[model samples]
Target: MELSPRGVNMKRAFIVPAIMVLFFSGCGKDKNEGGKTSPPQAKSESAAKSGGEKAQMPSRLQQAVKEGRISEEQARQIMARRAGGGDKPLVRLGTAARGEIRTHLVLNGTVEPERSVDVYARLSAYVQEVVREEGNRVREKDILARLDDTEIRISHQQAKIQLEQARLTLEEEKNNHQRNQELKENELISDMDFQASEARYRQSRLEFENKTENFKNLELQLNYTRIRAPVSGFVTQRLIEVGDRVTANQHVYTVEDFSPLLIRVFVPAADINKLQAGMNAEISSDTLPGRTFTGHIKLINPRIDVQSGTVKVTIEVNDSSLTLKPGMFVEVNIVTRSREDALVIPRTAVLYQRDQVLVFRFREGKAVAAPVSVGVTEDDRVEIVEGLEEGDTIIIQGAEMLKDGVEVSVLK
Candidate 1:
């Protein structure tokens, strides 16, 4: 301990090499003790074989948790996701209910009044008074607007005076002709003078008839100053106002009958045979949601359009509440066929594969595909004619990746 610095360094080096050699020798002795390998080495080989056998299973999930590769909760989740546990396709189910179903053709068209009349002015005159404005309800012959009748009335009065004067002159001529005839028959005057008097009386009679017709013409012209509604409906348009001059046959107002509206839809020629003049139709509008108006086929055009290959069909709507109006674009569903008390299901539940129609029926928490024969299809519903019964639960969603006997979790 008290040696020089060089002597102390040499002694420490010799003791460090001897200690390392003894440590290595002891490790070798433990590895081959009693002609057997160490316990840790044997355990590692056994684990490798066991891991290969259960690699695809969750048997090693707990070992992964112990090794800090995963959490304890994650290990439980992995085990739970195996077969005979919570692993299943999530799906929504719908019941096949017995109800009315129909086959229809959908089309879009503009709403028009059953009877839309354009009120026209018969005489050219300046509008004097506006009796009814737009949106005013009117009946047949209701005055919509009044025109200036000053000139017409004055002419009417003058014609009346002329008619009266002609009537007086005609009466005098008749008396004179009678007197002249008596004289001519009795030979109390010359033949030429009597003939001349007869001519004068005939001319006066002709003048009176002309004046009577002229007076009636003027009276009719005076009545034409008032523009009247031609039909009973709501006034939809007012083209004339106070001091607006309107001519003969000029459009002044538009009256539309909303009690029963009209919708003209052009249907394809292929579907023309299925339609008739009295088929039931359901009408709906985007502007008015959740409301359905009823109607029927009023007429179907016999001629088909050569260019478009579509036939024109007119629908007459029965809207007692006046909820529908003219010019509203609406969707029309013309029912071609219907079935009552038929088993129907959501259309999305059906799967079309080749020529067969299939649906996934939920039974015993599994998806079972069944072939179905469908009939009339209306909107999002289809009639189940075969292979399904009422009150059966079928998969409505999340069945795209499902196979036969595959487990499912039905959603509420």
Candidate 2:
């Protein structure tokens, strides 16, 4: 039956007062009975004791238990759940999908250029001008530095003059020889005189040839006084400055060709058979972070080093931008094997137990440690040969603490 607001308020006030009086009287009776009391009194005593215990509880929890909203055990369970969170373990998941995967044999090597040449002075002279310094790009026969060629130039000019004089004398001897031949043919001059003229002509010819060669040599020497690049590349080192004396065949500069950089690596003999020319490779440098370059195997030595038991492999990188420099430390990953449509998953998700390989497969909010046949294990990724299909979700991170059938909460 519905009651008016005024009647409801008046009834609540009377009931509250009666409840307080009954509680007080029950408490007083419990105190008076002391060790002995009737069944009803004993029940009142028990109620009073339980009420005191309930007062120590939180207000909301006391109200809930008193109103029969929740049992004591259920309340404790809720508080424990709130205190320690839920019992489900948190995990990161990844899907098994078909993708390209490759296995690499990693090796460390030093970056080298296609060619490196040491520019040397072909003639002894002092450096007169430094046209190109270190880090200067140059081409074949480009003048790098001009040596002091003043003395060589003067000598060359003198040789030229001598060569011209010799040529004139040779012409004169040739005419005399022709005249002598005619005279001998006509019997106008004696044989001895003709023979002597012929001899002189021959001597003049020899002298002319010798002078010609001497002039050519001087010209070559003059050209050598100018240091030039032997190949087209960058000047990586300059050992001479202006006014510095350099001897013939002395190293003056070092030039390197940066196009199609090369790297030589030594692989153990056991793995050498896996390598071949024209295989793809990945190149990276510690100095240039986050940058990757593509390359291919240029050469592979068939013979293995007896002492080191390793084979030398050459990697060629076509880095047109020249981002990688010679002598920089680099790492090379030779892709010896690959697959186009393989079941791939994170390598971290795989667990190795004894002779079996397992992965935590997430299904129905539970982790199932299932054994899988693993194929190629590459960097951070592994190829599953069997036991897992496409679109299957597996625990990637936080799988180390997982057991069979353990519930988990997948993190987004």
Evaluated with TM-score, which candidate comes out highest?
2
- For 1-412, candidate 1 gives per-residue lDDT tens digits of 4999999999999999999999998777535557766788787777766765564634555555575544665554454444335667666789999999978899999998878788889989999999998989899999988899999999999999999999999899889889988998999988998888888899999999999999999899888987888889899999887988889998888998887889999999999999999998899998999999889999999999999999999999978788888889999998888799999998878888899999899999899999999988887898999999889999976566789889887654
Name the TM-score of candidate 1: 0.73
Instruction: Name the TM-score of candidate 2.
Output: 0.73
Report the number of the highest-lDDT candidate: 2
Error of 1 at 177 (Å): 1.2
Q: What is the RMSD of candidate 1? A: 12.0
Cα shift from native, residue 114, model 1 (Å): 3.0
Our tally of clashes for model 2 stands at 0
| Superposed model 1: Cα runs more than 4 Å off | 1-85, 88-97, 360-369, 389-399, 405-412
lDDT of model 2, residue 95: 93
**For candidate 2, what is the lDDT?**
0.87
* lDDT by candidate, in order shown: 0.86, 0.87
Query: Which residue pairs does candidate 1 place in steric collision?
Result: none
